[model samples]
Target: MDLKDRKRTTRQRLFRSFCCAWAGLTLVVRHEQNMKFHLLAAAAAVICGFVFSIPLFHWMILVVIIGGMLALEVMNTAVERVVDMITEDYHPAAEKAKDIAAAAVLVYSAAAVVIGILIFYEPVMSRLFS
Candidate 1:
């Protein structure tokens, strides 16, 4: 293929990949219990941010935290699915892999909670006291 044709093909492939990723994300949101909870929590955070009129820097931080959380959950689901596909029966290695993957999400989630509290505490308390 010529250079132009090759570029067009690459663009098509990139779009296809993105579509597939969106499909996977939709499936997770629709079917995964944890993903559902994360979506709810993210929505709540966004509403809080709007209500508090958080600053630009805080908005940036919230965006990063929310995106990181969703991405991490996707990754955790991917890991679990891969492990399940590899074995039908229980295996110690598979269990360890799943546990570690889940632990990563849990650890990041804990940090995100701390950061969220730090970001919102002053605003919340000020509003309450005022």
Candidate 2:
């Protein structure tokens, strides 16, 4: 296949790029267990936000946190896949690469948990305890 296929218009190129990004997200959601967990957590947070009637500003903060966590997870998956492709053998650097990628996901997940608690704890407590 020649690299010079029919030239796409700007809109076509942008749509194709969006399709590729969506495909990547689908692949990660299908294959990555951690992504599933993050999404589930996000869903729960959104539910709690509605149930508690959290402020719009709080919702915005939640959105940012969710976005950051999901983006980090996708990047971590990409890094691990690239590292594994580069070397299948037991290389120290390969191990380090995977470990660091995992650590990034861990840190984000932990932060998201803390923020979720901060956002929901008071409302949940008042509803339950009061």
Candidate 3:
């Protein structure tokens, strides 16, 4: 292929990939309960950050934490779906895989909560006390 053709192909592929990724995200948002909860939590965090007028550094931290959490939840859903696809019947290995994936999200969620508290506690206290 000519250079022009190659560049066009690459751009097309990139656009297609982005479309697929967005579809996956919409699927999760529409069908996954956990993802819905994560979305709500993310929204709440962003709103609270604005309400508190959090610093740029804190905003960065919140962004990372929230993005990591949503990503992890999506991964967990993928894992669960793959496990179910592999076996319709109950299996210890499948159960373990699902549990481990879920545990990862759970651990990250706990950390996110702690980070949220750390970030918001001072601002909330100051607002109330002042």
Off by over 4 Å in 2: 1-6
TM-score of each: 0.93, 0.91, 0.93
TM-score of 2: 0.91
- Give the winner by TM-score: 2 or 3: 3
**lDDT, residue 109, model 2:** 85
Instruction: Report the lDDT tens digits of candidate 2 across residue range 1-82.
Output: 1233237776777777788789999999999999998999889899889999988888998999999999999999999899
| lDDT for model 3 | 0.94
**Cα lDDT of model 3 by residue, 1-130, tens digit:** 3355455677786777788789989988899999999999999999999999999999999999999999999899999999999999999999999999999999999999999999999999999999
- Which tens-of-lDDT digit does each residue in 1-130 have in candidate 1? 3355455667786777788789999989988999999989999999999998899999999999999999999999999999999998999999999999999999999999999999899999999999
In model 3, which range of ten residues has the least summed lDDT?
1-10
Residue 26 error for model 1, in Å? 0.9
Itemize residue pairs with steric clashes in candidate 1.
none
Q: What lDDT, from 0 to 1, does candidate 2 have? A: 0.89
What do the candidate models score in CA lDDT, each in turn? Answer: 0.93, 0.89, 0.94
Alpha-carbon runs more than 4 Å astray in model 3 = 1-8
